[model samples]
Target: MLRLLINIFFLSLVQGSVAGSEPYFSLADYDAASDREYIGAVGILSRPDLGLVITITVQSGGALLLGDPPVDKIPSTAVKRAVCGQVISFPNLPERNLVCR
Candidate 1:
């Protein structure tokens, strides 16, 4: 019974961490977008303990880059180790379903 209780406690911690690790952001549709208009919906940056949020920006002509500051256009292979996810939303347009992956 003691072992079962310990297992349950560890399982809860794992479940909580997984659920909290999801990265969310509302990227701008245009380069001219202001900081106020661009929203990191999850506000992950402030929580450094969560690790760096790898932002893959989808640009015109279907280009992807690290969207975060000192934004660079590089191969995704370089950032394979970073924990990342995408939050797709039309913040400037009509409301639609939010997609996270």
Candidate 2:
């Protein structure tokens, strides 16, 4: 049937062009190294029951800047990059400097 309709239109155009084409985070770059940016931040990773919304996004150079829904609204729920760096800004976790656990 026409090569299965051209292989389902090339697998739906390669799955809709890689579905949103991953790769987002970019807080200018890196941040946490061992907490101190405010006595809070040591490789972010928190889940007092999904208390904090924003998920993951951490480079490894310095500075760190880029807010307002930039780093693709950070969200790595599976818990890989392992983050919870002494943060405080969920309901009242405030004391921020770094976040992404």
Candidate with the greatest TM-score versus the true structure: 1
Q: What lDDT does each candidate get?
A: 0.31, 0.32
Give a tens-digit lDDT track for model 1, residues 1-101. Answer: 54345334323332122222223222324343433333322222211454333323443322233334313222232232232333333335332222223
Please provide, for model 2 over 1-46, each residue's C-alpha lDDT reduced to its tens digit, 9 standing for 90 to 100: 5434533432332212231333322222234564324222223324
Model 2 misplaced stretches (Cα beyond 4 Å): 1-23, 26-42, 51-57, 61-101
Q: Where does candidate 1 stray beyond 4 Å?
A: 1-50, 76-78, 81-101
**TM-score computed on alpha carbons, candidate 1:** 0.26
Best by lDDT: 2
Q: Indicate the worst ten consecutive residues by lDDT in candidate 1.
A: 13-22
